[model samples]
Target: MKENSTFAPKANALQDYQFTIIVPVYNEEENLPRVEKELLAYTKIASKKTGILFVNDGSKDNSQALIEETCTRNEGFNYISFKENRGLSAAIKAGFDHVETPLLGYIDSDLQTAPEDFNLLLEKIGEYDLVTGVRANRKDKFVKNMSSKIANGIRRAFTNDGMDDTGCPLKVIKTAYAKRIPMFKGLHRFLPAMILLQNGKVLQVPVQHFPRIAGKAKFGVWNRLLGPLMDCFAYLWMKKKYINYEIKSKGC
Candidate 1:
C-alpha cells in the first residue's frame, strides 16, 4: 500500500452517501474547476445519493489546493492525498478501500468522459456487479485511438472479457466486488476481468466521450501499447494464483 499522507473528509460524510465517485487527479490543475462544476451538477440529478472522492495522486501542481477547495465547499465531496505519485490504479484502489457506500464509481479528472452519463451505467448496475461505459465515437487523435484499439483487442483475446472499451473512464461497480479485487499496476484497465475473477457479472453500456479540454494526455504510444501487453501477462499470472471461495454456511 502507498502512503496516504492526508485524508480530508467531512465528518459523517458517508452516512447518507449511497454512491461515491472516485476522481483520480494527477497534475490536472487546469481542469479542476470545470471538473468541480460538472460533478456538482451530476450530484444534483443523480438517481442515488452521490458523493465525490477526489484522490490526489501526489499532484505536482495546484491540483491539491483546488481539490481541497472543491471538497471544502461541496457537502458530499472529500479527498485522499498520497505522499507521491501512485498512478491511476493505486488511486482507484485507495478509493475502493476507503469507500463506505454500497456503490462506487470512477472517472478521470481530464473530463473526457461526461459525469452525467453515469446514470446510464447505473441503470444496469442492479443486474451486473460492474457496469462500464463503451465510448461511442471517441473524440481523440488517430494515434491514440488506433493504439487503444490495438491494446483493447489484445486484452480481449487474452482475458476474453468482451469489453469494447475498457479504457473508458466512466464506470460503476458494487463496492463489495470492487473491494475484493487485488489491484496491481495497470489494473485500472482490467476492472471487468478482475470482477469476473470474483465470479461477478460485468456489463458495458455506450456513453458519451469528449476531447480533453485542458491539460495534456498522460499516456503515449508506448504506454498504451507495451503497457497492456505486460499487464495481460500479469493478469494471466494473477488468474492462475488467485484464490476465491464461497462459504455456504457461517455460524454467528
Candidate 2:
C-alpha cells in the first residue's frame, strides 16, 4: 500500500482532505495505464485527502490483471472485482457499499471526461450532497448526442430533477446520501433524481469533454434510448410510491 501523504510535493505543505473516486470499468485494458497516470496526477494536486477505487465489472479481458498490477504499483489506488458481468449501476453500488470516506466521486473509464475536473466538483461538495458535471462541448457522435439529449429531456420532464446532463460520468457525492440509494439495473442514469429523493441538493457544473482517444463506446441505441425510456417509467412508479418522513419526537 502507498503511504497516505499529507504534504504536497509542489508546495511542500500539509493539508486536510477526505474523498474517494470510484471508477467502474468493463474491458478497458487499453486505457488502464493512462487512467492510472491521470488519476495519480490529480490526487497529487487535489486539495483534499484522495484515493482511487477501480471496480471491475466482470470484464472478460485482462482488465482484472491490469487493475491488480496498477494497484500494486500505485499506493493510493485500490480495487474490487465482480465475479460476473454486472452492469454499471451494480459496479457503482458496490463502490458505494465499500467506500468509507466522507465524499465519494466517479468518472468513466473511457477517458472522455477529464479526471482533473473532479476538483471542480469537489469545490462545491460542501454546499451540495451531489455535484455532477455537465459536458460543456460533447464530442460524441450525432446519434449518441441526440439520443442523450432526448433522454435527458424525458428524464427531466418525468423526474423533474432539473439536471441537463445526467449522463455525464463525472460526479462527486457525499457518501452518506450515495449509500442510501436503492440499486437497480439503470439506476446509474438516475443518480441525481435519487439524490433528490433523499432531500439532498444537487449542483451541476460545466466540465471539459473530449473525443474518445481509445477503445469503443459501450452504449448502443437500445441501451442509450430504449433502456432509458423504460427506466423513466420505473422511476415514475417508484417516485409515486416512495416514502419519506421526519421524526418530531424521540425518547432515548
Candidate 3:
C-alpha cells in the first residue's frame, strides 16, 4: 500500500506495540474524539501492546481534520486518508494492506463495539486463525436489529461459516491470513469464511455493543439485508475456485 495522503509514523514510539487496531472512518467527525479517548485507554492495558491506525475513507466532512488532530496529540495514533469516498470494505482492505503487526484487529468509527473487548478476542488468538465478536445485548433499534438477524441467517446459509454475527465490527486476525484475503467491495462480510477457505480456524466470542452516540447510522434496511445477500453469491463463486496449498519440500 502506498503512503496515504499524509501519515507520520513515529518508529521509536511505535516499536513497542505488538498489535494494531484499524479504525475505519467515513464522515465520522462526531465519533473521532471519543474514538481517540477509548483507543488510547485500550492501548494502556491491551493484552499485547497495541496502537491505532485510523483509515479515513474519503469523508466529505471534517473527519480527516479530526483524525490528524487526534494523531498529533496521541502517542501511538497514526492515520491514512483516502482521496475519495470508498465503502467500508475498501477501508478494511486498506487497513489489511498496510498493517504490519502480527495480530491485526478492526473496529468501527461508530463506536458500536468496545475497544477494551479486543482483549477478549486477543486471548483466543493463539488457538484460532481468526477471532471475531458476537455482540451480546446489541443496542440497535428493533427494526435494524431484526434485519441484521435475518441477514446473518442468510449469510450463514450461503457461507456456512457458522458465525452468528459477521456484522459485528470487532475482530482480530493473524496478519498473514488477513493479507492473503482477496478483498472486494463487500468482502468484509465474508472475512471469517475467507479464513476458513485458507484452511484456518475461527472463534467467535461475545463482546459488548453500544448504541450510536454520535453520527448517523450508515446502513439502512436495503444495504443491511440486500447487500450481504448479494455478497453471498460472490463468496460462493470465489469459494469454488479458491486455492490453498502447503509446500512440504523446499530447499533454501
Candidate 4:
C-alpha cells in the first residue's frame, strides 16, 4: 500500500500518474545499482509520468536494503516485501493486486531488457489492452533461445494467441485487464493469452534485449522448456473453466 507520492499519496485523491512499472526482484543484488540508474533515467523521458514498484520476492541477499535505500532517495520509487519466497508468478500477482495506475508495466530486475524501450510499448498501449515486446536480436545463449522457441511454438499450438515471443518481460498492460488475470505458476508466459480471455486486444512490438550482465539466471534449459510445457496444460484448464460475463446495464 506504499503509494508513490509523485502522483497522489492520499486515499480518494486524483492520481496524476499514468503508469506503474513493476520490477520483480529476487536475489538480484548485483544488478540493482544499474537498474536504479536506468529506470530513473527512463522515468524522466517516459511518454507518461511513471512510478516504480519493486516487489521483493523474499531475497536472502542484500537486495531489500538496497530497495529501501532506493525508495527513500527517489521521488517515485516504492517497494513491497513478501515474508518468504513465492516465485515470480506470485511477485507479479502481488504487483497487479496493488497497482492503482491506469496502466501497469512489467520488467525484470536482471536488466536483460532495456527500460527505455518501455516508451515504445507505451506509445501503442492506447489502441491495445496489452502491448508486449518481442525481443529483437535476443542475446541469450543458444540453448536458452532454442528452448524458448520450442516453448513458444507449443504454446501457440495450444493457445493460438499469435504471439511470437510470449516470454518477453517488457510489457505494458491496462490495469483493469491486468488485474482480471488469475495468476498461476508460469503466468508470465501466457500474459497475452490471458488478455485475450478477457476479450482484450494485444499487440507485440520488438524491443532490445541483452545478455545477463549480473546475477545468475533463475531459469535453466529444463526450466525454460519443461516448465512452460506443463503450464500450457494449466492454461488450457483455466481457459475452459474461466468465467467471463458482461452486464450491459448497471444499477447505482
Candidate 5:
C-alpha cells in the first residue's frame, strides 16, 4: 500500500455491507500509533464490515504524517488532511461527507474513550439511527468532569435528548440520517438532538473510559461551558425553525 493510500477491503459477511469509522484528529501525534493499533484490533472483531477514516484537522504536529503512514500500512485505514486547522465539528462533518457507508461512527483520538467499546454501540445499531456511548466512569480532572456534567444536564433540560453523555466520542450513526444534519461550529455537541429532529431513534449504552495517556485537551472553559451554553440557544433556534418533510407521492 502506498503512503496516504485510501483503500479498505469490502466485507463478505453481508451483501453490500459498508461501515466507516471516522476519527477526527488534531495534533494528536503521540496517540496516533496506539489509536491505529487499537482500531485495527476492533475492526477485526467488529460486528459488521468496517473501515477507518481519519480527518486531519490541520495539526501543526506530526499527526498528519502519522495518519498517512498508518493508512499506507493498514488496508483498513484511510485519511484526509485539511489545509488549515479547523475545529472537531468541521473534521467530523468532513468525514460524514466523504464516507460512503451504511453505518458511520466516530471516536476521538484522545484515547479517553476505548475504541473496543465501539462494539457496544454497534451491537444496537440495527434498532437505532444513533447509538451513543455514555461514559460509564469518566476519567478526567474534577473541574472538567463537573463542567461536562453541568453542560450535559443543561442540554438535556433544553433539547430533551435524554442522553447522559452526548459529548462521549464513541458513537454509531446511520449514514442516511447523519448526512441530513445541519452543520454548525459546535453542532457536534447536538448530534442526538439533530437525529431527533429527523424523528430518528437514539440509544445510549454504558461504555468504558480511560485517562488521556498523552497530548493536551483541545477544549477549555470557553468551549466546554460558555461555548456550549451559546450553542444550546442555537440548537433551540434550529429546533424551532428547522424543516423536515416527506414526499408521499411517486414521480411520474
Candidate 6:
C-alpha cells in the first residue's frame, strides 16, 4: 500500500484516519478547483478526520498539474497520477489499493454529486458493510435518465442487488469490503453487488444530485447502457465462482 506521501505520515495506525475520499479525475481540469474547494470544506466539518485523495486517471489535459497544485496547497490533500488513462474503474481500484483509512469513499471529479452527502453515507456504515447513495432528484437529460433506468433494471434482474442507482457517484464503504472487490471495466456499477458477493451487507440512502458544473460526462449511452449490460454477464460468471472463507483456526 505504498503511496507518494508529500507531507508527514500519520503517527497512529491507519484506523486513526476516519475516511479517505477518493475523487477519480480524468481530464477534468475545469472541475479541479471546485473539487478542491468543496472537498476541503467538507473535511473541515467532517465528523471524522477526512482526507482527500485525487486519483488522476492518466488525464492528458492540465488536470494533473492542477491536482498536484491543490494537493500541495492543502494539508490533508493527496493524489496519484497515472502514466496513462485507465478509465474510472482502474483509478478507483488504485484508490482502494492505496487508501489506508478505516472508511473509503468515492466521488466524481465532476461536482454533480455533493461532497456533503458523504456524511449521510457514513452514518449508515455501522449497520452495513457498504452504504451507497441513490440520487433523489437526478439532474440529467431525458435520454440519459431513461438509459440509466433501463440499465439499472437489467442489472437488478441479473445480480439481484436491488440497487436503484448504482451509477450514483457518492458512497462510503468499509475499507475491508471495498478492497476485496474484484474490479473490472464497469466495476463502479457493480460495487453494491460485489459487496453482496462477499457476503457483506449493502444499504442505499437517498442523496442530493446536481447537473454537471464543469467538464462533460465521461460516460455516454454505450458505457452506461451497453457496457454494464455486458458486465452483468461477467458478474454472473464471477458470482458462480466467487469464494467466501472463515478463519476458524489460524497459526502464524
Point out where model 3 deviates above 4 Å.
Answer: 1-8, 11-15
Clashing pairs in 3: none
lDDT per residue for candidate 2 within 170-217, as digits (tens), equals 999999999888878897999999999989999999999999888778
Question: What is the C-alpha local distance difference test score of each model?
Answer: 0.93, 0.86, 0.90, 0.90, 0.87, 0.86
**Best of the candidates, lDDT:** 1
Using TM-score as the measure, name the better of candidate 3 and candidate 4: 3
TM-score, candidate 4, is 0.94
Between candidates 2 and 3, the one scoring higher on lDDT is: 3
Give a tens-digit lDDT track for model 4, residues 140-241: 999999999999999999899999999999999999999999999787789999999999999999999999989999999877888888999999999999
Model 1 Cα lDDT, one tens digit per residue, 52-106: 9999999999999999899888889999999999888999999999899999999
The Cα error of candidate 1 at residue 229, in Å, is 0.0
- For the record, the alpha-carbon RMSD of candidate 1 to the native fold, in angstroms, is 0.9
Quick one: ranking by TM-score, best first? 1, 3, 4, 6, 5, 2
Cα shift from native, residue 181, model 3 (Å): 0.5
Cα error of candidate 5 at position 33, Å: 0.7
**CA displacement after TM-score superposition, residue 65 of candidate 5 (Å):** 0.9
Between candidates 1 and 5, the TM-score winner: 1
Tell me the deviation in Å of residue 30 in model 2.
Answer: 0.5
| Model 4 worst lDDT window (10 residues) | 5-14
Which is the better candidate, 2 or 4, if ranked by TM-score? 4
lDDT of 3 by residue, 120-210 (tens): 9999999899999999999999999999999999999999999999989999999999999999888899999999999999999999999
